[model samples]
Target: MRPDELDTALNNLAAEHRLRQRAILHSPQGPHVRIDGRDYLAFASNDYLGLANHPALKTAMQQAIDDWGVGSGASALVAGHFAIQQQAETALAAFTGCEAALLFGSGYAANLGVISSLLGRGDAVFADKLNHASLNDGCLLSRATFRRFRHNDVAHLEQLLRDTPAKTRLIAVDAVYSMDGDEAPLAALLQLAERYDAWLYLDDAHGFGVLGEGRGVLFDHALHHPRVIYMATLGKAAGVAGAFVAASHSVVNWLINSARTYIFTTAHPPAQAAAVLASLQLIKDEGWRRLQLQRHISRRHLQSGVGGCQPAFGLAVLAWRVCR
Candidate 1:
C-alpha cells in the first residue's frame, strides 16, 4: 500500500479510541510539566519518582558525555558496549536480585528478543489477557501457539497449561496491568510454573521502582527461583530510558549471542546508561520516594470530594481516573 494510505489507516484507528488529543512538552517529564505551550499538571508520565530532570541524573549524563563523547557508534557486539553500560547492567542485576542482566534498546525490544529467542513453532506460550502489546507481539513473532488466559486468573492459567501439550511451555504475564492498573498474582503464577516446568516471564514495567520496596511485584512474591525471568524498563520509575532482562547467566549469554534485537541493534547511548545508573542509585537509597508514591496513591483512594472512584491498587505508574 502507499505510505499515505497506511498513514490514513493508522489515523482511523487512533480516531476510534477518542485518543486524538496531542500535547507538546516543552520541558522534561514530571508531575508539573510545560505542555501545549503552557505549564500544566501532568499525571501521565512514567516518572513516578520525579527524577528525569533531577540535578544528579543530569550531572551524571553530562559527565558521561564529557568522558565518552556521546554515541555508542555501533552494536554492543561490535565495540558499543562500554564500562557505563556494564556498570548499569550490573547495577540492574543487583537491584533485581538476578545473577545477570542483559540490556536492550527498549522494553518492547527486550520482550520481543527474549520471547522469540526462547520459544518457537513447537512451543506453547500462555499470556495474560491484559499483557502489554509488546508481549502479544512477541508471541506472534515467535511462531508459538499463543493462548490467552484470564487476566490474573491462576485457575484459568492452570487449565490452559494442562490443555496444551507442547514440548516447551512458556507463561508470560505482566507484573502490573498497565491500562487497568491492577496486579498479577505472582506467587500463584510461579507455583503453576514450577508445577508444569514452564518458564515464567514477568514484565514489571509498571511495578519496578514503585512496588515492593522498588524490587517489583514478582520480587515481592519472592519468586527468585531460576524458572522466573524478570523484565523491566528504566523509562518508567527510574526516570531514564532503556530496558533489561534479568535471568540466569546461561539465559543472559544466550540473549547476548542469539537475541536478534540485542545482537543487531545499536547499543544504547552510554550517557543514557550513566543516567540510568544514577537513577538506580536514587531508587535504591532513597526509600522515601516510594513511600511518598504510596501515600499519594492512598490519598487518591481516600479522596471522595473530587471523584467517587478510588485509585487502582498494587501499582503507582498512573493517576486515578477522576472524571468530573
Candidate 2:
C-alpha cells in the first residue's frame, strides 16, 4: 500500500503490456492515423462504416445543440431526460426491430444496467467463455451463480442447460466477439434459448451498423421474439458515442425503474444522440461499406504477405510483409 510499492506495481504492469504489445496514438480515430508522430495505415478502430467523420453527423449534432442545449443536466429520472433522448430511443427501437429501447451513457453502463437489473441472487447466468468483460463483470455484480460455456459450443451449452436447475436462467453472449472477429452461432444459440426456457441476451457491440442490412446479428439471422434482448454500443460501428438496450417494452420499463446505472448516471447529451441518429441513417442507406469491409478482411488474410488468420478466432494479426 506504500506509494513506492504502488509505483513499482504500476510500472511492472506497463512493462508487461509492452512485452506483449504496445499502443501509440497521435491522431484522430480513423483508417489512417499518426502513431507516435509516424503515420500508419490503421486498422485498429471499430469505425467500420467510416462515418465517424461524416459532416452530416456533425451538422446534426450542431442542430441538436441549438434545440436541446448541451448537458443532460441530471439523470433520466431527474431533469436530464429530453425529447431528443426519447426520439433517439424511438429511432433505435425502430432500427433494431424491438418493442422499445433505453439509451445509456455508454455500452459498459448499458450492459451493467440490464444484466444486474435482471439477474440477482439464486438466478443462474450462463455466459460464453469469450463474452465482453462488461458482461462477465455484470454477472459477478448480480450475485448470481455464473457458468461459462465453451465459446460457440452449442452442445456444451445444452449439457450445462440440462444440468441447471429448473429456475429462471439468463444466457449472455456477444453477437460478434470483439478480440476475435468471428460471429456467434445465432440460430443455434436461439434454439438453445428456446429449449432451455431462458432469456437470451446478445451484446452486438461490434456488429451493429455493420451487419443484417445494418440492423445487427439478430436481424441478420432473421430471428425475433420476446425471449431475446439486444444490447449494442453506438461508439463502435455506429460511428458515435453512447449505448442502448432494445427489448420488450416491459423489460425497458423494468430497467427504467430498477437499473441503478441508468437511474444514477447522467444521460448522454442530446448532441451525441443527434450524431448517432445521423450515423444510423448512413449505415442503413449504404451497402457498399459493409461489402468492402468483408472483402478487405478476407483478402488481407488470404495474402501470404499478411499471413493467414487462425480460422477459429477470426482474430486479426497485423504483420509487416517480409520481402524475399
Candidate 3:
C-alpha cells in the first residue's frame, strides 16, 4: 500500500470511531487495576480466576529468575528446553488427559503453529465465523480450503463437511467464547468431525481456570476423542505466560518437528513456567474462586435480567457480561 492509501485508511478509521489505543497499566492484573493515572475496577482482563497477582506465583517467578536466569537462551530444540518446562508440560498433559503436550511462546503462536502444521494445500479447514483472528490467519497461512460456518451452527458445518472434497480436514473453534460467555457445542462438533473424518481443534483459553472444576471445557462436558486437539493459554487463568497444545503423542511429535513458529522463535522465559506451576497448584486447591466467579456472574445475568444472550446451535448458550 502507498503512503496516501495508508493515510486515507487511518483517517477513515478515526472518522468512524473505530480506531483504538493502548492504555498504560500501572498495577498488576486483577479485578481492580490502575490504568492511565486512574484506579478502576477492571473487567477487560482475561485473568478469570484472578491469580495473576498471587504471592505464590511471584515467589516462584523470582526464584526461577535467580536460578535459571531470564531467557531460555535459545529455542526449545536448540538447548533451550529446561526441566521446569518439561515438568509443566507433563503436568499440563496429565491435567488435560492428553497423551502429550507441547508449549509455545504464546496463544497466538500456538494456534498459528498447530493449524499451519496440520493442514497444507490439500487439506480443508472448517472454522466458526466468530473464531479468534489468529485461527483465521492460521488457516489462510496454511493455504487450505478454508470454509467458515455460521457461528455455533452445526447444520452449516455439516453441510460444508459434506461438500468438501479435501482429504485432510480440521474443525477449529473456541471452547468458551469470551465475548459471548457461551460455550461451543463440543460433543456435537466432535460427532460431526468423526463423521467427516476431520480433526477438531479447540482453543480453551477462557475455559481453563474458570470451567470444568479448573480443568477446562473437556472435563466440564465429559467429552473426549482421539480426533481432538486441545490448546489453552496459561496467561489467562493459569496466571502466567505461554500456551500449550495437548493431543495425541503423534500430533505433538509432528508439531515439534514441523511447526515453524515453534521451531524458529526463542523459548519463553523459564521463570514463566515456574509461575505457571505455582498457578496450577492454586487452581487445584482453590475451589472457592470458581464459586465466587459463578456468584458474580449470576448476579448480573440471572438476577439483573439485563443484557441476556440468546441460545445458539439449538442449545442454551449462556450469556456473559463484560463488567460487573
Candidate 4:
C-alpha cells in the first residue's frame, strides 16, 4: 500500500474514535497509576490481585538479575532456556495439576503456537465466537477448517462438532470471556469433547491467579481431563511476564518439539521467570488478595446498583454494563 493510503486509513480511524495509542507509564502498574506525567485512578490493568508492584516480587526480580544477568540472549532451543524457566514451568504444571507445562513469551504467542502446532490443513478447529483475537488468528494460521459457534452456546458447538467430518477436531474457548466477563461452560464443553473425540483447549488467561483461589477455572471446576489443554498468562493476575500451556505430558512434549513460536523466540529474561516463581508462591499462600478482589467486585456491584445481578467477574478489571 502507498504511504498516502496508510495515512488515509489512520485518519479514518481517528475520525471514528478507534485510533489506538500507547500511554507512557511513569509509575508501576496498580489500581492508581501515573501516565504521561499525569496521575489517574487507573482501573484499566489486568493485574487482578494488585500484585504488579508487590515488594516481594520486586526483590525476587532484583535477586534474579544479580544471579543471572539481564537477558536470555538466544532462542529457547538455542541455549536460552534457563533453570528459572524450567522451575517456573514445573511449578506451573504442579499448580494447575497438569502433567506438564510449556512456557511462552506471551499469551498471544502461546495461543498461536499451541493452535497452529496442533491443528493443520486436514484438521478442524471449533472456537467460541467471543474468544480472544489471538485464538482466532491461530486457527486461521493453522490452515484448518475453522468454525465459530455462538458465544458460550454449547449446543451450537455440539452441532458444529457433529457435522465436522475432519479426523482431528479441536475446540478452543476462553475460560473467562475477556470482553463480556462471563465464564465459559467448560464442563459442558468437556462433555462434548468427550463424546466427539475432540481436543479441548481452554485459555484461562483472565481467570488464572484470581479464580479458584489462584489455581484457575480448571482446578475450580475439576475439569482436568486428558483431552483438555489449559493455558494461563502470568502477566495478568500472576504479576509476572509470560504465559504457560499445561496439558498431558505428550501434548507438552509435542509443543516443545513442533511449536514454531516456542522454537524460534528467545526465552523471556531469566529474572522474569525468577519473579514468577515468587509470585506463584505468593498466590498460593496469600488468600487475602483473592478476598480483596471479591470485595471490590461486590462494592462495584453495590455502587453501580446492579443488585442481585453480579456483573460478570473480571475481578480487578471491572467493566460496567449500562442499560440505555
Candidate 5:
C-alpha cells in the first residue's frame, strides 16, 4: 500500500469517529476521576470492587518493592519466579478452587498462551462469537480448526461440536461478558463439554473478585469438572496487575512447560504479585464492596430505564455507562 493510502485510511477512521484516543488521567482510579484538567464521574474502569486504590494494596506493593525491588529481572523459568509469585499463584488457585494455577503478564497473554498451548492442527476450537479478542487471536495462532457459534448460543455450540470430527476439541467462552454485564451459560456449556468430550475454557476476567461472593462463576455454579480451564485477570476486578489460568494440575503443568507466552516473556514485577495477594484477601473478606457495586449497577440501570432486560453477551448497551 502507498503512504497516501495509509493516510487516507487514518483520515477516514477519524472522520467516522472510529479512531481511538487515550484519556490523560490525573488522578487515581475510582468512581470519580480527573482527566485533562477536568473532573468527571468515571464509569469506564474494570475495578469493580473499588480496590484498585485501596490503601492496603498500596502498602503491600510498597513493602514488596522494598523486599523484591521493581522488576523480576528475568523470565519465570530462569530466575524470575520469586516467592511472591508463587504465593500469589497459590492464593489464586485456592480462591478459584482450582487444582493449580499459572500466572501470565496480562490477560491477553494468558488467553493466548492457554489456547495456543492446548490446541493445534488436527484439533478444533469452538468459541463464542463474542469472546475477547485475545481468545480469537489465540485460536487463530494455534492453527486449529476454529469455529465460532452465535454468542451465548449453547445450541449452536452443541451442533458445531457434534459435527466436528477433530479428535481433540476445546470450547472457550467468557464467564461474564465484560462489555454487556451479562453472564454466559457456563453450566450448559459445561454439560456440552462433558457430552462432547471437549475441554472448556472459561475466561472470568470480569467476574472474578466480584461474582459468586468473589470466588467467580465456576465456583458459584459448582462446575468444577476436570475438563474445565479457568482464566481470570488481576488488572481488572482483582485490583492489581497480571492474569492467571487455573485448571487441573496436569493442565497447568502442561502450560508451564509448553505455553510460549509464559515461557518467553519476562515475569511481572514481584511487587505486583504481593499487591495481588493482598487484593485476593480483600476480595474474600470484604463483601461490602460487591454489595456496593450491585447497588450502583441497579441504580444505573434504573436511571437509564433499561430495566432488567439483558443484552447480548459482550456488547455494551450504553456506550458510556458502567455496566461491567
Candidate 6:
C-alpha cells in the first residue's frame, strides 16, 4: 500500500473510533497504578495473585541477576537455555502432571509455535469462536483447514471434527474465557477429541495460578490425557513473565526441534525464570490468595461503578473480567 492509501485507512479507523492509544503507567502493576499521572485502582493488570510486586519474587530475581546477569543474549536453541529455565520447565511439568515442558517468550508465542509446528496443510484446526487471537493466528499460519465452532458448543465442534477429512486434527480453546469470566468445558472437549482422534491444545493463561486450588482448569476438571497439550503464561497469576507448554516428551522434543518461534526468538531472561520459581512455591503455599480472588469474582458487582483505564469489556490482557 502507498503512503496515501495507508493514511486513508488510518483516518477511516480513527473516524470509526477503532484506533487505540497506549496509557503510560508510572507505577507497578497491581490493584493500584499511576496512569497519566493519575493514581487509579487498576483492574487492567493480569497480576491475579499480587505476585508482580511481591518481595519474594523481587529478591529471587535480584539474586538471579547477581548470579546470571541480565539478558539471555541468545535463543534457547543456541546458548541461552539456562538451567533456571529448565528447572522452571520441570516444575511446571510436574505441577501439570505432564511428561515434559518447554518455555516460550509468551502465551502468544507458545500457541503460534506449537500449533503451526504441529498442524499444516491437509490437517484441520477446530477452534473456539471466542479463543484468544493468538490461537486464531496460529491456525491461519499453519495453512490448515480452520474451523471455528460457537463458543463451548460441543455439538458443533463434533460435527466439524466428524466432517473433516484431515487425519491430523487439533482442537484449540482457552481454558477460561477471559472476557466472559467463564471456563471452557475441557472434559467434554477432551471427549470429543478422543472420539474424533484429534488432539487438544489448551491455553490456560487465565486459569493457572488462579483456579482449582491453584493447579488450573485441568485440576478443576480432574482431566489429564496424552492427547492434551497445556500452555500457561507465568506473567499472570504466576506473576513473573514468559509462558510454557507442557505435554508428552515426544511432543516437547518436536516443538524444540521444529517450532520456529522457539528456535529464532531470544530466550526469556533467566532472572525472570528465577522469579517464576519463587512464584510457583508461593502459588502452592498461599491458598488465601486464590480464596481472595474467588471473593473478588463473587463480589464483582460491587465494582461495577468503579472507573479506570479499562472499559466495560475488552481484551483479557488489559483488563480482569473478574473485576468487571
Q: Which ranges of candidate 5 are over 4 A from the true structure? A: 1-4, 307-324
Candidate 2 structure quality by residue, lDDT tens digits, 1-324: 887797787788788884345678877666577887788776456666677777889899999999999998888899899987888899999999999999998888888888899888888889999999999988899888899999989998999988988488888999888775678888888888898898999999887887788899768998677889999999877878989999999999999999999999887797898897888888888887777666555555676344433221222212211110
Per-residue lDDT tens digits for candidate 4, residues 224-312, read: 99999999999988988889999999999999999999998888899998889899999999998788777777777777777544455
Query: Candidate 5, residues 1-324: lDDT per residue as tens digits?
Result: 797699899889999999988989999987678999999877567676778899999999999999999989999999999999999889889998989899999989999999899898999999998898999999999999999999999999999999999999999999887667678899899899999999999998888877788998878899888999999999887888889999899999999999999999899999999999999989888898777666666665666677556442222212222443
Clashes of 6: 0
Off by over 4 Å in 4: 307-315, 318-324
Cα lDDT listed for each candidate: 0.84, 0.82, 0.85, 0.88, 0.86, 0.86
Error of 4 at 202 (Å): 0.4
Worst 10 residues of 6 by lDDT: 308-317
- The weakest ten consecutive residues by lDDT in model 5 span 312-321
State each model's C-alpha RMSD to the native.
3.3, 3.8, 3.5, 3.1, 2.8, 3.9
**Which 10 consecutive residues of model 1 have the lowest summed lDDT?**
315-324
Report the Cα lDDT for residue 213, model 5.
88
Please tell me which predicted candidate would have the highest TM-score against the true structure. Answer: 4
After TM-score superposition, what is the CA distance of residue 241 in candidate 6 from its true location, in Å? Answer: 1.4
The TM-score, computed over Cα atoms with residue i paired to residue i, of candidate 1 is: 0.91
Better of 4 and 5 by TM-score: 4
Residue 319, candidate 3: C-alpha displacement in angstroms:
14
Segments in model 6 whose C-alpha atoms lie over 4 Å from true places:
301-324
> How high is each candidate's TM-score?
0.91, 0.90, 0.93, 0.95, 0.94, 0.92
For candidate 5, the TM-score is 0.94
